[model samples]
Target: MPVTTQSWVVTQRLPDLLFAADARDEPISLTAADYRALHWAWSEAIGDYTRRTVTKPGDKLVAFAAIAELFQRTWRAEYLAGLWRPTLLQDLLWATNYEGRAPRPERYRAPSWSWAAVDGHVVASLLDDWLGAGVGTAVQRCEVLECEVVPATPLLPLGKVLSGTLRLRAAMVKATWDPDAQLPVLYAALDRLEEATLTSPPATSPAPELTQIGCAYPDSTEDACEIWAVPVLWNKAEKYAAGLVITPAATEGVYRRVGCFHSPEPDEDPGRLVWMLEQKKQEIIII
Candidate 1:
């Protein structure tokens, strides 16, 4: 059985500036043009983080790598040039209390979040044995569904691109599941994503089996999280919209009938779980 939890991934082509954290002494300055090459001394490296430092090595170097120009145009370009290493820490861990951990991920299981097919590549990096240079800590947090997290793993400093997403999961999950839920930096980044669909790939997907988890908070909340998504349509232009199905409110239609996850959010974690379901919906749109 797939152990469900909150997670997301970013997918994009390999960049030239991406260095190996294992090669701490390698050149860090790189442009999009250098993303892929046959030979580089330290191309494959994994970064590590502990809760002590304000910023880790991977954050420092990867941040520079994300922006090709930062290294090229800064007044201290030559001085900062020496800091380019794959192990650069763009994010550092902060100590916080988390009650439980996300269940160990199952193979080929649906991640708590999804992305365009291309973005899936970056998402897969976390599972790698060497684990790459930038994604470990947050993954560790996700292990416990540490709700207070910033979710920096999926962004990857954007190879200097620094972008966002389309729609994101509303923080309406069960308190039992989302523990310390709060708005995350990744929440805001989703905005850069196009509101409308960009793909029209046909939906030959098999019907997904629905596995309903009872709403953690129902009376004062929006709707419960969906168990799984079924491929009902493939038309990206038609676009998919999810909402709440209200039956009691009829005075002026203050409530939605269904698919109303538009923002202002729900009362609690039940909404958070539903939001994760919507994240899957967004993946369907992009796919």
Candidate 2:
């Protein structure tokens, strides 16, 4: 003799339950552990839910919750919990506030530098304030040693990223934090100074050139940051040579990509920038 349940009543409560799924008593920081979990989740989920599908500002949270539910039974409980942490949720919302239509990778997936790579919350370094004048060569060249991914399925958005590796020939320099910018700033000495001209127009002045770029480290919460700025050929025709920024992880010789930094200034020929960096290219891996 059990009471019969009403379908309408259950339907009415569904929205409330979904919205309440992420309620928390306190905020949580995006720790190294959290970042690792996030990276894995993103690699698996982004293919199913393209960044282009996110239309509204609030859609990101809704999408995140849905993805978390899909992985609830498979992933560790702690890893799923990190996704809903109040601070992390807020950061995701802030980072996804792009004005125009999001960029979609022409290939099967999003590019590594794209937020689409990991459609989750992102937080910059908290210690960027103390950054002052700095000098040193950080990363000279990079090679994608290996990249592998499993095909996607109905339940899984992106199959699974089996293993990925990057080989970098870097100088490795301690970075300074720029508090105002809330990101680590690195001043790296560029190789082949004459090559720098490839990215810029005919020189108007002989100014001492330095590649000043912002860097992010996935798992690090340290004030004294170590970063590498590896040149990438983002667009050959536009002559766009982007800085694929990365930072070391706990494992020796292992690095996690932070993001890419490109100069805002217009370049007439971006292909030269790619050529300049390609001089050191060894191998390319499609992720």
Winning model by TM-score: 2
Tell me the whole-model lDDT of each prediction, alpha carbons only.
0.22, 0.35
Q: What TM-score fits each model?
A: 0.19, 0.35
Tens digit of per-residue lDDT, candidate 1, span 103-156: 212221111121110111111111122122233332211111111212234443
Deviation in angstroms for 159 in model 2? 8.8
What's the lDDT of the predicted structure labeled candidate 2? Answer: 0.35
Q: Model 2 — TM-score against the truth?
A: 0.35
Candidate 2, residue 236: the lDDT equals 36
Where model 2 places Cα greater than 4 Å from the true spot, the runs are: 1-145, 149-186, 191-209, 213-224, 267-279, 282-287
Tens-digit per-residue lDDT, 1-287, candidate 2:
11112311222323222233246444334455554454444443433343344554333323344444533323324221223222221112112222222333223232243343444333321211111012112222244343333323334333222233334332232233331243444455444345445567655535544544333333222232455555532333333333445556556656554443442223422224432443444432222
Candidate 2: residue pairs that collide: 128-177, 128-178, 128-179, 129-178, 129-179, 131-177, 238-270, 239-270, 239-271, 240-270
